[model samples]
Target: MSPKSLCFTVLVAVFSVLASRVVINPTPQVLKYVVDFGLTISSSPSIVAMFIPFDFDDLRRHHKNPDKGKPVSVCEDFPPNFPPPETNTTLTLCVDRNGCCNFTTVQAAVDAVPNLSIKRTVIWINSGIYYEKVIVPKTKPNITFQGQGYTSTAIAWNDTALSANGTFFSGSVQVFSTNFIAKNISFMNVAPIPHPGDVGAQAVAIRIAGDQAAFWGCGFFGAQDTLHDDRGRHYFKDCYIQGSIDFIFGNGKSLYEGCQLLSMANPVAPGSKSINGAVTAHGRASADENSGFAFVNCSVGGTGRIWLGRAWRPFSRVVFALTSMTDIIAPEGWNDFNDPTRDQSIFYGEYNCTGAGANMSGRAAYVQRLNDTQASVFLNTSYIDGDQWLLSYDT
Candidate 1:
């Protein structure tokens, strides 16, 4: 071969080797900035593109590696909100406005009980309007309140945001005790109906503060703040929940099976907002998190019109599975709670939901339709698992 051709061939071989090294070893800058920020690197011309930058510290704080070998318990950690359980005692406080058990007040009966214990106790409330604010704390569990009738045995209070210091979301009938149950009762908050432009008032009717609490055939009536399924895991079966605004809003993971959600007109919105206001604002804070509210086989329709729900928090996750919705449900199905930015992170979904409102044609792109396997995770009852606990309640 000629000397010039040989020299050119050697130069081409060196260039190929250099190119191979560059492709194999990414630059230090790329490693430090691009890979650490979850960027993808392409090799045609060596390009780095960031899809989603994940913050490892934030992830570590939010999620920990699961201890797979840890034994699961029937009852997890208890909150400080429940009252001590009552045992071996049956206390009947019949507060009839004018009849037998003539105590006119419900608070008097609650006060009459001595320190609660870890035993079974029943407080039979008669048919009357007991105007009082009642609270059952974490120390008091296993307390059953049986009412004479769903509508006749009424506990009415009208505590509004103006009456207290907290916001509408804070109005709650918190139940923290375990194994607490209420049957055939009505919890109503008769707060003054909001005037034509008042937007910032809340009157909470019932708040379940206890854990392992169940309500059967109960009625929760109010314009807003109707049933504060505030915290813990609650089971409400065959119950009626009525509200106007974001009535059912909280962080508790509750299951409402075979219940009725009634909607009243928003006094402020008038003609613009329709009647049945938002149904729920579940306060879950993470995507892979377990805290949320689920409505199974429930019917969502009321006398008035309203949106099905809106995001109460940025990462709020709620699911309506196999439920029947009415025409009153808005086409959008879910709202961003008046803020458009929250739509990016919220997980509002429906599986096998049927009704005029369940149509997904108008749903936002962020709303998801979970597949069968993903949906099964929500049914598991070891906390989020589908244990036999949900079956224990008699709806």
Candidate 2:
């Protein structure tokens, strides 16, 4: 069968079975330095037929009720247990660059929140470009960043890793507090994208190390290391994240629902067919760490051919379920970060993803052919344990 035939069609139901066991690709070659402008694929002699898994009953039930106490809306949510008796439990601080609001910058509003307060402090940012780096310290939890709109309200900076002394400090906005939320905001790193061999080219748009954080209708713009989802259980709904190499990296156990992953890397240079860049470089360093990335009902589209994900560290785990991928995905599907040894340890899988690039014929050997029992683990809010804290979500 052709590589296209091996892929799941857009109409294919995940609950159905993939009945055939066949080696669709005769040869699999890693395309890095080779000129591959045409994105030509050569088949290889590999034994492959994989299982497609899905909990049909559970999926239907979950969709019937997506809001499970997770803070699903930006304008309609308050911290849990903020009884109506205490009017001070909910606070709204306005930030306007024009000085019409309570604060002139995003940071000032964040500073106004009392440290370690149980109340939810909402910082409403007016529509404008706020050129500054803002950090919500770990001490200040339960804060919400509410903006007029993602495109109209932006917090931007132009600090490269070299300029910031390291990638850890280069984010336009860094949040270290728990239960943080962002709505209709854009966090941007405006530094010029760097080419290969360029020193410290990484520019981070946002870094979220806080647990139980949620982002709704947010946009993250940058080149490399765009989202430092460094370590946490985070939810990103209807968000747009654009970047180049290792853009969406970090060890966060995140669920990217209905988000768009855009690539900005110049994959082909001139006549060179060489492909560069990857959508995600999940940095799960150990098997014991309950950290992984799950993209559900997301779309991957943009310039340049890149891997859906690459193993940035040993035991890196990432899965894309029911996502629509374009031809931008490289044939190899994934990379072991150029280290063959790491391949055995990484957990990479795709469950019922559809697109021209969704064919598994030329995927890496380590790609998991998940069964329903296995796929269920990463296909829904349960992957991030949203039942515990999140009040609700869209299916």
Candidate 3:
């Protein structure tokens, strides 16, 4: 069979099984809607179908059936008799707001896990918007937040630096525990983007102050201080991060692989002509800090003129290798954080990067155009000691 037909057949088979467990507003019209939608699923077939949100009215108008109405029970799809094994070392707790599974809130589920447990615990968050400030404290470890999909599951908040707590404490989702993994989730800070006279508008979508943490197929969205990769050895792969000012800043010895860094339009400050933003502000205070930002096989694009990075601390280090940059990047890329003295210690470099902004002619004199020998050091998993913690989730 053709690939499209094969995909449809598989989806039909999968959803047919799911339909047995789920009553999809059960009516002949609804049943016909299933058949029509199932055939349309060929384009983006996902075998993992569950309680996917569907518009009942939209379906009913398109097809007619004589079956009477009844209250739909989402729990039927997840029977208690088939509860997850109790002794299963690799536990997965489902978080459904409508009391369909184990817990209703994400924090409640996180609180249930034992601290410092050796076994990996997976918190499977359903497709919905969770408005909460989540934190995985230092005492907890080996935890994974698995979302349905990047666009489908989101955690959002509106905290800012001006809050009773400072910017350092203003993360919508802060992870301090080691060996944490977040997949297919979007972390958002809904606070207004900083503007002129906007005091303490450093809203952070997510903060990683943990070691051996990894993010895959995730998204971070905000305007200023979008992602605080605060401190640790971390890895971000196939993720999307969008912001305007110092969006991807931190002191973490981390690697961003195949990720997208989007720069929003400039937020003009008072009396400023053509205001712009910087993508990163690495804060490596000393040479012994063992922290830097590595962008490997990543892409930088979006609106507004911006600098690739600025040194938040004297010894800050950052490298962009085999990445793509758009003309949005400032010709003189790396900034010295308005401190000329930082020019002497900061290590900002790029290697084999292609795009309109990759021209070395106008790049800052201090920014290195690394040769193969130097580029090798920052282009692999070794940059974040991934050999030790990233083996299990190598995708």
The best candidate by lDDT is: 3
Whole-structure CA lDDT of model 2 = 0.75
Model 3 residue 32 lDDT? 18
Give residue 30's lDDT in candidate 2 (0 to 100).
11
lDDT tens digits by residue: candidate 3, 158-206: 6789872788789989999988999988887766566534688888989
* Model 1 accuracy (lDDT, Cα): 0.61
Ranking by TM-score: 3, 2, 1
The TM-score, computed over Cα atoms with residue i paired to residue i, of candidate 3 is 0.80
Model 1 TM-score (2 dp): 0.68
Model 1 clash tally, residue pairs: 36
lDDT of each candidate versus the true structure: 0.61, 0.75, 0.76
What are the per-model C-alpha RMSD values against the true structure? 28.2, 16.6, 12.3
Cα lDDT tens digits, model 1, 341-370, are 888888787888898878888876777887
lDDT of 2 at 127: 65
Which parts of model 3 are misplaced by more than 4 Å?
1-70, 78-83, 86-88, 267-275
For candidate 1, which ten residues in a row score worst on lDDT?
28-37
Residue 50, model 2, lDDT: 12
The per-candidate count of clashes, in order, stands at 36, 17, 0
TM accuracy, model 2: 0.77
lDDT per residue for candidate 2 within 94-210, as digits (tens), equals 886545547888998898889999888878786656767899999999888987666457787767899899998999899999999999888877665666557897889999999
